[model samples]
Target: LTVTMRQRPSFVVVGEVRGAEAFTVFQAMSIGRYVFATFHADDIETFIHRMESKPINIPRNLMLTLDVVIILSNLSSDRGSLRRIKTVSEITGQDQLTSEIVVNNAFTWNSVTDTNPYSGFSYVLKRIAEKEGKFEADLEKEVDIRSKILDKMIEKQITNYKEFYNLVNLFYKDRVRLFETLDMTEEVLM
Candidate 1:
């Protein structure tokens, strides 16, 4: 896979580089290909701390593979405004240690204080409910159930990695055809 990518460089977006995929991802980036990837890095310290922790398991040899490390924070600004970003970072693997990554603040977002009664997160689900299809109602029901479950989870304390991992592994029922059915991809991971 790495050789094939090197032979034909292409833009790749990885959802998360949490496991052994980190090695190949690093090699591909080092070899020159436009790659945009994000792990659970919320801050530089968090990123550094995490690289030194488990689940990330980034090999020491492949540590400085990224050309950029964009950090996202959900912190509210001092001005009582919510902040979101399409931030940018330039990764320099020059110095081994004591090298601080540079971040360029590209954009900021305003907070939504008042609720517009017309808005909700279940728009897609609502549309699916209205649509006439074999699993249309099932999709809507699933979305609603998921939303409720997520809300309940959010109300509770932080979820452990094992719990989330179990959820992911369990949710991926018949993943072999899930992608093909969505017309996203026909290839199976395994």
Candidate 2:
């Protein structure tokens, strides 16, 4: 971890955060480096409890640096076993009185519909909007547009990572052209 930090990378990824490594991960996040790591926990509450106790013992104050937590779960169904994102939660802050981490679930999966619906307001999105000098509504529109593009990709069976990466880059380079090619329109924003 120290060697990687010396290289000054923009992002750091750990397969799984366990034991003392959690400290270093939080340290990297504290210094503004985006750290992505998978931790074993059934839910956000359990995750917090575990982190604040035992061998990990991550300080509750340090947990404030975490921006988001995406929980994935595997489920078995008539269609067989599949993995789905259970929740996408943003760590808003720590409660002043209780000192407990405040998390906002931006998206959550509905088992009945098998869809991950956006829960409306998102502190993470708001922060991003402020940083980019754009309205939160504009960012929401962008997310909707991108979601449509991804749906189109899935329909066309563009599952390969390289293909998805290249097409996403193209969208970034010329969004109008990409929309035209995908038979989509900016009308969704309206």
Q: Pick the candidate with the highest TM-score.
A: 2
TM-score of each: 0.41, 0.94
List model 2 lDDT by residue over 98-149, tens digit each: 8779999999999999989999899999999999999999899889888899
Give, for candidate 2, the lowest lDDT window spanning 10 residues.
Answer: 181-190
Candidate 2 regions with alpha-carbon error over 4 angstroms: 186-190
- Each prediction's RMSD to truth: 14.9, 1.5
- Candidate 1 per-residue C-alpha lDDT over 56-144 given as tens digits, one digit per residue, 9 for 90 to 100: 66654455565456566566556675435423343334354745433333222223542112122333344446764536557745555
The residue pairs in collision within model 2 are none
Question: Candidate 1 local accuracy as lDDT?
Answer: 0.52
Name the best candidate (by lDDT): 2
